[model samples]
Target: MAASHPLLAVRGLQAGYGRAQVLFDIGFEVHPGQVVTLLGRNGMGRSTTIKCLFGMLPVLGGHVEVRGRPVNGHASHRIAREGLSLVPEGRQIFTDLSVEENLVATARRPRTDDGRAPWTLERVYALWPRLKERRHNLGWQLSGGEQQMLAIGRALMTNPTLLVLDEATEGLAPVIRDEIWRTLATLKQEGLAQIVIDKNVKRLLPLADRHYVLEKGRVVWQGDSAALHAQPAIVQQYLGV
Candidate 1:
């Protein structure tokens, strides 16, 4: 199928910390109901790109657009309210809060025109049944996989149109990682657009619609899954796995 208008677009994005520039002319797009993976080894501006998108870092240059609306200079909260949600690298959850509370804390009613009701505690529980079993457990009490699920659930509570997951399956057991991947596949079936950062190319290849390979603060390659499969050398060279 032909790609549609991007739900999120990054054009000529440049960002840095203090005097050091990290990203150079970074650009990519994530269409509705599509999953886009940003692939790179450590310190190649992957996280920096995400920070710029969420306004967590100052943008030295470039523009970030959501649904074609400019959000380059907007506050992080404002950016999120505009239907973009980020699940940061670490499974950042409220340790003192109960499972249900954490999910409800970020819950937002869906817009009237959204055509679907906002996600409920029950729906989230269904996605991760362990959360339902530990509905009253604190964030710290949950295992890594459970915490990851809670983080994703919290983001879903916001009823975002686009979900950005930084290191989605970074540090989990093999089985847990499989569960996470299965959940992502389910979300894909439900038509959620996502920007995912992960190193598991084998799993990512099947889940993501497109891939962007970054090297030293720039996108070196961009293409669909089939194209990526045809270029294993490119993956071996840049990914180093």
Candidate 2:
């Protein structure tokens, strides 16, 4: 069972781009070592929530907390220091940097109080040997799959407590998608908490401990796998499953 206290919490979160409001009273919690997902169609404010959590967007109302500490208005770097790291929607890699440079660019040892082992450059290369093979290649030289792997490796180098992946497998080949899923499963087994957003509901159902389904920027449903399985109607209604 997971701990009672949440590792990351977002309550009444509201945000938007410019004068357009996209989120309404959005809320959720990610417990230690647990895997959760934000489920919704495009333009449903899923990415907006992620942006607010990382302080990339201003919060209209609400708060985000990490390990019981408030960090809603904090900068992205501050959020990373609080143990959150993100693999954004697109595999946005530094086009000019080599694979090794990308991995080390944002790498940092965890806070002394963090009990997990540090994620070193060597560790990331070991996790994806293709990265090691392409270590000297510029990001733009990599194939789509290789760039995705590099993106994930870069995030891992942050030594995060909770990893947030937005459209983690977007635009990847089926084989590469399988590889990404396998990596996430391995990370879960290693007890790294995660918040994932993906369109592949079938793939997510088995992996996520809990799910929050968003509709028009509100949480229409929140439940575990079993509960989700029991309510196929809700899945069809909001998720178009």
Instruction: Give candidate 1's error at residue 35 in angstroms.
Output: 0.7
Provide the overall lDDT of each model, using Cα atoms, as 2-decimal numbers: 0.89, 0.91
The TM-score obtained by model 2 is 0.96
Models 1 onward score TM values of 0.96, 0.96
> In lDDT terms, which candidate is top?
2
lDDT of 2 by residue, 1-241 (tens): 4677899989999888888999999999999889999998888889989999999999999888888899978989988998889999888999899999999999988765456668998888888999999999999999999999989999999889899999989999999999999999999988899999998888988899999999999998999988998998887888784
Per-candidate clash tally: 0, 0
| Candidate 2 local lDDT, residue 108 | 82
